[model samples]
Target: MIRSLKEEIYKFIHQKNSLYGLVALVLLMIYSALTSKTNADSLISVFGAIEWIPIILIAIGSAFFAMEYSNNTILLLLYKNSERSKIYIAKFLTILLYGIVLATTSIITALLLSIVLKSRQYNLFTVIAGKTILIQLGLNILGMIIYSLFAVAMSFMLIMLIRVNAVVICIGLAWGFFGTSLSTALMKTLPTISNILKWNPLNMVFISQQLSKPHYYRVSQLSNLQLIMGTLFYSLLFAILGYLLFRRRRV
Candidate 1:
């Protein structure tokens, strides 16, 4: 399991798409910081970049498995002595690790830039230590991590089922970008049946919003606990489904 995991990490690190994704993330972070006219805090930049995480993870997750299938490399891995479950688990871990690294780097980059360039007049350490900033930053980081896992699980399920990169990317992006609006519209349009769609993974991704806004229930029609539980439940549900299908899938 360790060997398989290591190989998965190594492959992810060497992948050109992964490298390109990092570059794009960095560019987006810088752009966001530059555009923040009033509030150019490290936390702001970090959160801004994180808004793109779902799209990034979707691209990474889809490509990670699809590449193997496209190159016929999955066949070679299957012939190795590793169990199918281990292979899928290794891939899932790779996605999780990448997401963590991406979020960590975004925070670090934002902090450095904030202190050195963005906030030259104020002491960044003091600002970061402030109660509100600290809490908000912590919540933002936590939300991004959870949502990243959500992206990984959902993308894994989609990619495994269709084995199509384009379709997975489209569905992932659509959900990431417009999911909240769609949910709201559904709730407004079908007030009677809206409860059924409220537990969807798309609605659960509003965790960041719920965390930042104390009055989130008024806006999202969901309590913080609901969002948290929904996120965890759907993430696990999709992951298990993906694993079950993957184990029996013919490479």
Candidate 2:
């Protein structure tokens, strides 16, 4: 399993689409630096911004996998006696591993730029800045991993069932950009939709808006226990669905 995963990840890393994920890391750091309020705060927030970095790479993953499916390579893999589940797991793990590496790269890059340029005036040692920065990193990274996984599942669904490249990219971007709006609309409807869509990670952004204290947002609203259970439920649900679909696919 380990060797298979390693080779899968290596192939993914060497792909042109995989290189696009690096652009995400750079953009994430840039966005973090610019949006952060204080010079000192920027340092902290740049690292924190790592949390959602996986999200930026989701498009790349979708396009990559979708291409494979569209080109019939995925079918070729299956013909070689590769189990669908193993292939899906390997591809999924590769994207996730890339996310982690991307986050680390962004964090280190931001820190290095801060040191070499001394231009941002973002002092590295401010306590509030430092603490909140880490907090943001945690939030962003966790959100990205979860959301990116969402994309991975979406990729499998569309690639196998719907083969249009432009359509897939359009849908992925639409969701990536406005997904929270769907969550909000569902949450706002009159009929007890809370239980239905609370399981949706898209709701996390909307709930985040209601936060009086950013750090405590998840803890206060859902309680740590509820959040954990809900997250686990969603993750398991999507993972199972993706696996079943892949297994049952005729290609």
Candidate 3:
């Protein structure tokens, strides 16, 4: 398992998209900070850049998984390892590690930007929405960690089923951007089971927003703890199903 993880990490680092994704995240943060109209907006923009992490992670992860099959290298990988489970877990962990890197970059960039752009207005200890900015940032990061797990698992399952990187990426991007809206529409259309639908994975994506703004519960209809648990449940479910499909797939 350790060897497989190391290989995955090596490959992940060498992938051009990994570097490109990191650069895109930093650039987005810079743009958000520079364009903010107010000090509070600047702070929000810093963490707001985190909302894009799922989109970036999905694109990279889909391509990572698809490349092996598209290039006819999956057979070589299986031949080299002969343990499909290790390969799958390693790849998943690599993607999660990448997510962590992106999250860290966002937080560090947010701190630096806050210092440069809103030094007089706020600090990490400053209060926002009744909680310290530091606490809010931590909650945001926690929500992001859970969301990243779901996004990685979902992308893996989609790639396993779809095989085509482009199609998987398109679907993943759509979900990242509009999944919550779709969830809301469904709940309203099916008012009878709206309560149950609130636990859907799409609605779970709002964990980050709900964490930062406690009042967002009115929109998600779920407490922060419930969102965390639901997101985790879906993450595990997708990952397990994806692995099963991967194991049965012919090389």
Best candidate per lDDT, number? 3
* Model 3 weakest 10-residue run by lDDT: 38-47
Sort all candidates by TM-score, best to worst: 3, 1, 2
Write candidate 1's Cα lDDT for 1-251 as tens digits.
99999999999999888888778888887777677642434464373765787789988888998898889998899999458888999999999999988888888877766764546554333344333655666677787888888889998999889888999999987997898888887788888877786776668768755675556676567787788778888889999999987887886
lDDT of 2 by residue, 126-245 (tens): 345235544644554454455455556665565555656567667666665676667656666734757665657665432222221255443224554455455556556666776776
Judge candidate 3 against the unseen true structure and give its global Cα lDDT, from 0 to 1: 0.85
The per-model lDDT (C-alpha) reads: 0.78, 0.58, 0.85
The runs of at least 3 residues in candidate 3 whose Cα sits more than 4 Å from the true structure, single-residue gaps closed, are 44-47
| Alpha carbon lDDT at 5, candidate 3 | 98
RMSD of 3: 1.5
Error of 1 at 236 (Å): 0.5
lDDT order, best first, reads: 3, 1, 2
How badly does each model clash, as a count of residue pairs?
0, 6, 0
Candidate 2: worst 10 consecutive residues by lDDT? Answer: 204-213
The residue-by-residue lDDT of candidate 3 on 1-251, one tens digit each, is 99999999999899899999999999988887776554754565354665788878888998999889988999899999998999999999999999999998988888787776655766668887788877777777888888999989989998898888888888877887898899989998998998899988889889866787788788788998998899999999999999998999987
Candidate with more favorable, higher lDDT: 2 or 3? 3
Tell me each candidate's RMSD, in Å, in order: 2.6, 4.1, 1.5
Model 2, position 202, has a per-residue lDDT of 60
Report the lDDT of model 2 for residue 73: 81
